[model samples]
Target chain A: MADANAETDLKQTPLHDLHVELGARMVPFAGYSMPVQYKAGIMAEHLHTRSKAGLFDVSHMGQAFLIGPDHETTARALEALTPSSFVELGLGRQRYSVLLNEEGGIIDDLMVTRPVSEEDDGKLMLVVNAARKDIDYAHFRDRLPENVSLQVVEDRALIAVQGPEAVAAVAAHAPKAAELAFMSAASMEFDGIDCHIARAGYTGEDGVEMSVPAGAAEAVARALLADDRVQPIGLGARDSLRLEAGLCLYGHDIDETTSPVEGAITFCMQKRRREEGGFPGDERIQAELKNGPGRVRVGLRLDGKAPAREGAEIALPDGPVIGTVTSGGFAPTVGAPIAMGYLPVEYAGTGTALELIVRGRRLPATVADMPFVPNRYYRKPKS
Target chain B: MTTYYSKDHEWISVEGDIATIGITSYAQEQLGDVVYVELPEAGRNLSQGDEAAVVESVKAASEVYAPIDGEVVEANGVLADEPAKVNADPEGGAWFLKMKVGNSGQLSDLMDQAAYKAYVETL
Candidate 1:
């Protein structure tokens, strides 16, 4: 992808050649040559994923295992560095967490999963943002005790099959993956290929993310593509899909200077961690949770077709600027322009009227509840 | 009647004192899947190189500048409902507007089809 010869320094995913063969328009992303869109273009691909299933190559993200002598040792050590309830994390269960700096700003958002069986040797698996992977590994290396070590799993490719039909499509090859509940993980064979499948994804859909060995990645991808429901989706639709789902794209919506509470993702910070207050930035995070953050992320619905892209100024009606847009775009699901930005608590209300300076014109907008489209994540019924 | 192209990828077809304006086929291909088009009002006057219209794709919004100074005579209303026409027929049905040519002298600066084809290859 990305012309392959555009820049010799850029890395390529295992599915890179497959994307090019599928007529994907590749672009530079997170230092890798990734597909931005296919021949169907962004709009159709986005709508198709919401209706059926879309397979995305996410191998650029960092995958690693924290190995220790036993479960308690690794879980406790991980909990010490992150604001997550990892100690109570049930076997086979996974929880989303943020790595924070000493001052409480987020270093990165990641997923930590406790292995389902003892054969994994008390390894806690982590999947971090592609751009923040290197920095995160360094951070973990510098802090872990001698007994605990980080094992980077670079010889693997990750793919996400998402949408309403994702479960049925994946269940065809890895039947056990269908039985796993939301936020659960299991090791299974996909068409005889070994893989680690997780019943989770970023698209706000009922989906599974599979991690397969590098050599077998292409075969796995081809098998998935053979299904009519699963088409190769590119990053263009991925951004819009996640935006409609109100999910944050790490570096765009949150960064080193943003707190988990300010980012409106305190739900990821479990209650036990909230009270125990042992992780980095607990002092600042706790204070913010108690006193409320200075600025909070909120959604905006624009009045017209002209989208208020990122970096647009958030202002009151003919008044002074109060915040800046972090992510904004033409949300195909909403059929209008939608934006997410951090605004003062007073202006974060759903009915608050605001203005966005887009393309040198003041566009009228109003604060609205997020997930411009409702989240369709599937949850099993309690017996 | 003769057609001229601008380096910015706009095309103008001149017939007497009236000229029709639209983006070139190459421009439409580069923009890809036009979802919306914003054209100037019929009576508005424009100078050569003025930002006359805006075309929006799924990923970005691009300006369509005036190729020659003129007063807008009419805008293609059909494009408002069917913006994809710009991609399907950039030069004919998707013309953005018709203008009363303000100065014929400005036409000398534009490239003919042969020259534009050569210029595009260099890009």
Candidate 2:
């Protein structure tokens, strides 16, 4: 039974009432009542996002901006916090990066985007994990130079529409967003309401994530829902889709102790950032970059139908526990159980035989390649 | 023959000394799409309220408790290959196991069809 205080303490998004009206099974997520699954269930919601389009209420995510006098100062200020090269991030483009603590451990993973509008030149927008929002804001408030400021956007809602048919479903209302290249963002009128839409998502699908005004969120969502090709997805499918795409979930796949190198996300750091060593944890990151991390995150494909979850022991095929599963579940797209975990570098190679100790049974598994399902981002044809 | 329900959401239908056990339809609905099921091995002795089988959905795993003391005689191996059957026909073809009752009198401790319905409504 849900505790009374816990239920009362749970926050609701702008679309909470809409979720209930649609017969959504609301569950507490990151201190908010988020939909884990709708009536169609996780399986159907997951499959629909792969074939058609799935609308997700991601408003629980933390949205904020780092403000400065110009783009350089703003980007440089952010570059000090994360390993990624933000200065070179062009207008309309977005880059994924992680916030590192003084020890170089990941504090949180976030997406940084430079808005396309010229009026927004001096500000870099950020979207962080909901659970870490307070930590992130406090960290920024304490660290950012006096010349720069951190402004949290509390009145906006993030709506993500992902899948193969996502673009068509959303483009019917916001035509300019359809023109965006993957990793690009644009300010456009979505259903006649001003929204910041980006052609990027966690699901590894061709889709858009729109930052809409909180009050207009439902109207915009209802407009997109009118499309026959779209379905409202719950957080349950959101997790499975990202797992199949080989994406990491903060506090699970990574934490304050895990470095970006060990987390298998080195690409977020550009060559300049890697060589300059200006970011937090650069000393350890540079060392790991040269010598390789002692342990690395790898994908695991279990043999049987039984799904092994987070904290399951990962063992060598013939003996001994070596690591623990970080994120795992039944991948609806792959039609099999898939998982990701940290393993000793020696045993992290693809095709390496492994075993997952679940329910006291050592189930056979293999060190498989990631993105159990392929990423289908909509990239522009090169000129 | 009589069907009895446990508060843990498992149902056991007793016929003579043999009893068939499975999760209730309400339990299956709460579990969502079942991906896997692990049943007790034949000859495994279970006391009332002991975990007798495991039912796994895409979200997580749940233990189905033995409503009454029994010795597992046979498990429905078909569930291993097609676990979704539990969601499709939870009360019928998807019965978890067949057991020889250890104490038929313990069956009296379980809820009857109508009483079980009322108990579920309270939840």
Pairs of colliding residues, candidate 1: none
> Tens-digit lDDT track for model 2 on B20-103?
999899999999999999999999999988989999898999999888888999999999999999999999999999999999
Instruction: Report the poorest 10 consecutive residues by lDDT, candidate 1 chain A.
Output: A1-10
For candidate 2 chain B, the 10 contiguous residues with the lowest summed lDDT are B61-70
Chain A TM-scores for all candidates read: 0.97, 0.99
Strongest candidate by lDDT:
2
lDDT for each residue of candidate 1 in A295-350, tens digit (9 for 90 to 100): 99999998877787789999999999999999888887787779899999978999
Segments in model 2 whose C-alpha atoms lie over 4 Å from true places: none
> Alpha-carbon error at A357 in model 1, in Å?
1.3
State every prediction's TM-score relative to the real structure: 0.93, 0.99
Count backbone overlaps in model 2: 0
Model 1, position A303: C-alpha lDDT score: 86
